[model samples]
Target: MNIKQSIAIIALLAATVWFWQTQPARPAPRVSFKTIKGANITPADLKGKPVLVTFWATDCPGCIEEIPHLIELHRQYSQAGLTIIAVAMHYDPPNHVLAMAEAKQLPYAVALDPSGSLAQNFGNVQLTPTTFLLDRNGRIVMQKVGVFDLRDMRQRLQAID
Candidate 1:
């Protein structure tokens, strides 16, 4: 390669290394909530377990569409140290959230974030169906803002399991 080409390649490599070294690690947020069943739930409650925290709203079409997938994931992984919690957004009416939870018969714990405290804890989650996957050590391993791939999510959960 020419000297100029070599110099450019070296600069590119340096930039890549710098970027990787400087990027801050994202740790999972410490979150706690009260389930609709009046049971208090927290990350501490599921220590050593891989957890999926999903923020959703009753009015969100995407959120509704993802419910079945979430339910399936919970069923397949709950026995393998996977904990899934569905948190209803504050904008969604509490009654509606409760009614939908019952109608859907969600197999996992369903919580209502009435004051948005839990949402705020997770980077002020404003988008419906925002999901966070936490590792067994409670680290934020992945965050999906919209629709997420179920297969990919399953693979990650399997790794943590």
Candidate 2:
């Protein structure tokens, strides 16, 4: 190969390697928030229980679309030591959360993070319906950005228990 071609190939390889290494590890950000039922929910509180933290906005279509699956997952897994804690990052007021939850008929425990503290803590949460699957030891195992798959979430929970 010509000198220029050889140099270009080497540069491309180096860039690819750098990009691969620089990718942020999946689900590293540990998040904690308060439950609407006047309880403190944190990583330490979830020890020995597989926890699913879902960040959702009431206005997002993806978030709204996944509500039924989320509800079913909670009903099926709650008895199995799996805890689903939903943190709402919707910009609307707290009353809006209640209204939305009531309208959606969501029975799972949910919390309002009005300041978007939980979302911000996990990183830039510009996307709606971001979820993190955490093992029994409170370590994040996987992160779903748009829509969460109940099957995948169940598999992760099985890994812990």
In order of listing, the candidates' clash counts read 0, 0
The weakest ten consecutive residues by lDDT in model 2 span 20-29
Per-residue lDDT tens digits of candidate 1, residues 1-161? Answer: 99999999999988885564334447778778799999998767978989899999999999999999999998999998788899999988989988999999998988989899999988888888898888888888887777778998989888886
What's each prediction's TM-score? 0.83, 0.76
Write down the lDDT that model 1 would get. 0.86
Candidate 2 residue lDDT tens string, 26-94: 544555677667777776667788777788877789988889988888888889888888788848577
Model 2 steric clash pairs = none
lDDT agreement with native, every candidate: 0.86, 0.76
The best candidate by TM-score is 1
Best by lDDT: 1
In Å, residue 142's CA in model 1 sits off its true spot by: 0.5
Residue 65 of model 2: what lDDT? 85
